[model samples]
Structure formats: structure tokens, C-alpha cells
Target chain A: MKKKAIIYGVSLGPGDPDLITLKGLKILQEADKIYYPGSLFKSGLKSSYSLSILEHYKLDTTKFEGFYLEMDLTRVKVNELYDLTFEKIIEDYNKDLKIAIVSEGDVNTFSSFSYLLEKIKKENFNVKLIPGITSFALAAAENLAPLCLQNEKLIILPRVQTETELEEALTHFNTVVLMKIKTVMNVINNVLSKGNYSIYYSEKLGTTHQFITSNLEEINKRDIPYFSLITIKK
Target chain B: MKKKAIIYGVSLGPGDPDLITLKGLKILQEADKIYYPGSLFKSGLKSSYSLSILEHYKLDTTKFEGFYLEMDLTRVKVNELYDLTFEKIIEDYNKDLKIAIVSEGDVNTFSSFSYLLEKIKKENFNVKLIPGITSFALAAAENLAPLCLQNEKLIILPRVQTETELEEALTHFNTVVLMKIKTVMNVINNVLSKGNYSIYYSEKLGTTHQFITSNLEEINKRDIPYFSLITIKK
Candidate 1:
């Protein structure tokens, strides 16, 4: 009987296949099966960033089985997704199948991998996290500025949340990274205006459609996307 | 005559040759001349990480024209280094030659590149920043933990000054990354203890001698090196 079943929570660095780490690529090549979160799109494909890296490795998703989870962040839904994924792992455990679960960014940061991690730990399955290039790092890279200076404090908050959370993060941090800017641009812009923080907005960093602007007023006038990031440096 | 001369701020990621990004590699390959920060121990030799990647491409340090900066960050030494490097770039600019300035990590993060940047901006030279992987990302990857959470705030501070700054950072941030830990471990440890934060320590992340420990008590017993990092998760 196989005594150990290894699960790798791999981060596919910000949307670029070339940006994926050598270690991440190595795991993708070696894993007996690769699991990625599927979307609710009509075609039933995985997320765009992870799919690119997986395709770069010549790994055919059709060949290996995939587990789909609803794109919801509520605790109950997240827990359900993990439970289902864990059950699949348990069934494959006796066969000594090594599984790789790929996340868009670093596994421990705003990733579904955390939920799975909790479930796996409860089931006594051994799991390891493989970190990758985060969108924040990529956005900073595109801007040619440091995200957080030597003594600078940085706050990373989701933009789709309540305005109170945004205001608190803005006031407290030396550098604030507001993710998912499309959903709450007006509120974020109003907060930025009130705080007197200059904004650097980036969309699709590293891709052909990548747009970066330091003008907050100009950004407010444009249509922002879900993947856009806004940085306010103090 | 070309009105603009390109200056590349290249990141040689985390002491590994292959870890450099495709864009970073392209800049190195295409640059008219490559300049690296020089060390007293080995003048004109490429940094170990840069050398590794260059070797794969059949490029030798001896083949490229080299410039050395012997500026120390302590006291007023950094200014002298900046002046000398800036003068070299100015000379090249006068000659209509484009230059590439490479550093070990991302150009803007806790790097000497900023000093040079200040000088260049003062002189009004056309400059472009090329991003590379930072040690923080590598450290996180080596430890297999995410550096920042979904809504969590992060603070990155170098131990260049007093502990009061660190304490202030801790009070406002959820995650704190303390760089240059060798010189200020005692003060940083005190702050971590006072804050009641769990600490993760990584020494020489990504290299053969890499060591990571979450046991703060054990960390205190070990001699922390220059490459060591202390992360406080609140």
C-alpha cells in the first residue's frame, strides 16, 4: 500500500508563461495529475493564467481529470469545494498518484488552496505550497517602482469590498494595492482623492493589453477591468 | 543623433541564473554594454547569479566591458558610488552608446539602483526600469508560504536603523518582512515578541545552504547571516 500521497499547491505567476518559476515548471512536468480550478464559462476551461502555463508545458488538460468548483468566496462554498477535492485525493491516495493543484498566484495568498489545505490537514494528507510571482509584484515591475520601500508599510485589499475597509487600508498603509479595481473604482477614486494619494493603475500586466497610468483622473475616466490594480504610494 | 539613450535597470533574481525573466534576459542579450555593481573581492567579474545565466548563453564577463562601483551604503559612501556610476553613464551617453545597469534583485527594491536613479533623474537621462524577481519572493518560495494574504497588509523594512521604525511598522501591518536581518536581529526579535507575532526565518533562500524555521526560540540560538530574513505574521 502507498503510505504517502503528495499534493502540491502551485502558483502560476501573473499571467505570463515565461514568468513561471523553473521549480514550478518542474513540478508541472513531474506530477502524475494536475488539478486546477475550473470556471463557469460555457467552454468549462480553467482560469486564463494557469491555463497558459499548463499549455506551455504541453500538458493536455483533456488527458487528466479536472475538478470544478463554483467561483464563490463564501466560507460554506469554499469548504464544500475543498471537501470534494479532498475526497478525490483520498480515492487516488492508495494508487500513489502525485497531485498538483495550481493556483493563479501564491498559494497562501487569497487562493482557494487555503481551503483545500485546511481540509487536507484534517484528513492527514501531506501537502506542500509552491509560491509563484504575485500580481502585485508584476504590477510594480510594470511601473518600475518598488512596491514597498525598506521602511514602507504596504496594504493589499480587495476593491470589491465595503468602503469602510478601503478607507481604513488607505489611511493606515504607506503603500496600498487595491485589487479588482473595476468593481469599485468610484469609491476607490473618491477615497484616493480625499487621501491625496497619487495613483498608478495597471491592467493586464505582462500581457499585450497591459496599460499603466500614473494619472488618477485619467484612470477614473476609463473603463477598468476586474484584473486591474491601483497603487497609491506615500 | 539619437535623442534618447536607454538605461536598463535589470534584476538578476535571487542568486539563480535561470531565475531571470525572459524580458530581463533579452535586455542583457541586446544591450550595447552591460554594467554590474563591482565588488572589492572580484572586480569586473559578474555576480555569481548573473554569471550562471550568462554562462548558459556563452557570454563571459571578460568579454563585456565592465564598470565597478565600490560604494558602501553605510554613512556617505553610497553618494560617492552613485556619482562615479552616474559619471560613467553620462560619458556613455555623450558617446551615443546605450547602457544596461544590472543588479542582483529587482532594481527598485532595497537596491543601490535608487541612488543611481536619483542621479540620472537629476541629470535628465532617459531611463527605463526592467523588473526582476526580488529576494522576498524567493524567500517566500523557498519557505513555501505566501507573503501576503487576501486582505492582509504587509510591511517590508530593512534593519538599517532603529527598532522604533520596526515597532511602528508592526503596529500597522499584518505581515512584516525584515530584510538585512544579520545586523538587527535582537531588536527585531524583541519587536516580534512584543507584538506576539509568529516568526518565520529563512537563511540563503533558494541556495543549497537554505534553512527555514518557524521556531522563534530556536532562531534565537542560531547565528543569523546577512542573507537571512525574518517574517512576522500577525
Candidate 2:
């Protein structure tokens, strides 16, 4: 009997195709099937970074499945998506086929793929993770700034409840990276102003809409997209 | 007059020759000259990574020059290296030739190339920065782990620091990456024990001496090289 092939969760990195790691590109080329998450109304086009690799290599997208995972989901809806994706993956596994599930940035960072990893692991399915270039790296590169100073502390946080957490992070670390900044810009700006830290903000880094700004007041004046980042340097 | 060809700082990422970015490879192939740091030791090897790239492309290393930086003080040494390198680069610029300076990882992240950029800017030299794969991504991929957690915080700091600094970083962030871990294993271990965080250490990631260990206590029993990375996850 053939040993069951494993499922590889790969990060395609930000939008630029070349930023994908050699290992990531190799796995994408070799994998039997590629999977990406999408919404009910959209195809995999929303997460086109992974799609570009398949399209560039002229790989077959017919086998490319879009598993639905509602962004705003109740517990039941989340479980339903998980069950459906898991069932599809297991079906492929039983037939001695391998799958590559792609994420935008590093698989472990702010990725929905973790829920799937946990579901598959519970069923004893072997999974491998391949990390890739992160948006934070791209943002820092575009700004030509160091993420952290020598002996200076750093923290990267997604938006959390309470301004206290944001304040704590800002107070404790010399540098801070706030992901999903649209919702918490006011709180972050207040903290930055209070702490007197130099601020840098990048939106949709490595993409066409990518913009970097140092002025938080200007950032507040405009409505920013969901995929935004703010870095505070003390 | 021909536009002065721009200076590009390219990072090859760790030690894998193939891991060099497509953009970086293109720059290297087209650039009239390549510059690397360090002097010819008693051994004739100029640069381990640069030599590998040259050998792979069937180019001669003798055509390239080494800019040696004296190790007296950090800022002064970096300035000296940059001044010397810029002079050689400007000589080529006078002939309307482009130059590419290759570093080990993404040029903006703890890379010596940043010093060159600062010097060039101060002297009003036109330059462009081409970002490349960072070792953090490579190391995370090698370990098959995520560098940061979703909705959690991440902190990156150098291990060559006082024990207090390390403790402060660990205390504040959900995930912490300590680069250059070889020399400060004892201090790192002390912080790990005090903070009660699990340590995942990777040495020479993507290269031969690459090893990952979660056993914090075992770090003291082993010898670590300069390229090692340690991740403390809460």
C-alpha cells in the first residue's frame, strides 16, 4: 500500500510572485492539488497571489477548490466550513493524493489556515507548513527603515479589545507593529502621541495601492483599507 | 549624459544559492560591479555567499572588490566601510556603470548594507533599494513553524544584549525572535528560565549546521554559532 501523501500549508507571501520562497514555489509546482480560501460570492480571485503561481505555470485550476470560510461567522458556521473543507481534504488523502493549501503571508501569522490545521491534526492527518515573506518585511523594506533598533524591543499585535492592551504594548516595546489597523487607528494614534514615538504606516504593501505615511493625523483623515499596518518607533 | 546607474542592495537570504530573489539575480547579472564586505583573510576566500553566486554563474571573483571595515566602533567602522565602498562605486559611476552590493538577508533588517545606504544618502548619492528574502522567513520555514500567531504579538530583538533587555522583550510579547544567538546562549537561557517561555532555536537555518531545539535547558550544553536564531513563544 502507498503511504498517504501529506498536506502542505504554504504561504505565498505578499502579492509579488518572486517574493515566494524557493521552497514554497517548489511545493506549489509539485503538489497534486492547490486549495485557497474564498467567500460564497467570490472565487479564488480575491486571494490571487496563490492563483498567480498556478496561472503562471499553466497549472490546472480545475482541481483548484475554493473552500468557503465566512469572515464574519458564528460558531456553527465556522464549524460547518471546517467540516466541509476537512471532508474534501480527507477524500483526496484517501486516494494517495497530496494537497497544497495556500495562505497570503506566513502560514502561522494571522491566517485562517490554523483552524484547518487543528481540524486535520485532530483526525491524525499529517500536515507540513512552509513559511514565506511577510507583509511586515515588505512594509519595512519599502520605508527603508529598521524594524527594531539594536537592543530595542519590538512587538507586533493584531487589534485587540480595550485600549489598555495597545497602550501596554506601546509602553513596553521600543517598536510596535499593529496589524488590522483600521479599527484601532484612533487608539494607536493616541498612544503614539502620548509616547512621542515616530510613526510609519503602510497600506496594502507590495501591491498597487501600497502607500507609506508618517503622519497619523493624515491617516485618520482618510478611510484606510482593512489591510493596513502601523509601526511605532521609540 | 546617461543617468547615473542606481546602486541596488541585494540580499541573497541565508546560504542557499538558489534562494536568491529573481530581481536580485537579475541585478547581479546586469550590474557592472559587485561589492562585498571584509578583507581577504590568510585564506583567499573573499565571501562564502558571493563566491558561490560567482561560481554558479561562471563569473570571476577577482573582478569584484572587497571593502574592509575596521572593527573599532560600530558607527565609525560602518561609516569607514561605506566611505571606502562609495568612493569605488563613484569611480564606476563616473564611467556610467551600475553596482550591486549583496548582503545576507533583506537589506533593511539588521543588514550592514543599511550603513552604506545612510552614507550614500548623506553624500547625496542616488540609490535604490531592492528588497530580498530575509533569514527570519527562511529560518521559520526550516523549522516548519509560524513566526507570529494570529491576533497575537511578536517581538524581534538581537540576543547580544543585556539580560534585562531580553527579559523585558519576553515579558511583553507573545512571540519573540532573538537573532545572532550564538554568543549569548547563557543570557538567553537565563531569560527563558526567568520568563518561563519555550525556546525554539534554529542554527544556520537553510544551511548544513541547521538544527532546531525546543529544549531550553539543553542550550547550555551545546556550542552555538553566530547565525543561530532563538524564538520564545508564550
Top lDDT model: 2
Candidate 2: misplaced stretches above 4 Å?
A41-49, A52-57, A119-128, A160-172, A194-196, B38-50, B53-64, B68-78, B123-126, B160-164, B194-196
Candidate 1: pairs in clash:
none
Q: Evaluate model 2 with DockQ and give the value.
A: 0.46
Candidate 2 steric clashes: 0
Model 2 chain A worst lDDT run, 10 consecutive residues: A40-49
Q: What RMSD, rounded to one decimal, does every model reach?
A: 4.2, 3.4
TM-score of each: 0.81, 0.86
Question: Alpha-carbon error at A46 in model 2, in Å?
Answer: 6.8
lDDT of 2 by residue, A1-234 (tens): 438578988777776666666666777778888898755423433444456544655556676887766555577986897788889888888877878998886677777787787776777777777765677767777776666544556667888556798777767667777888777777776666676777888887767777889887878876788778887777
* Structural RMSD, model 2: 3.4
What TM-score does structure 1 among the candidates reach?
A: 0.81
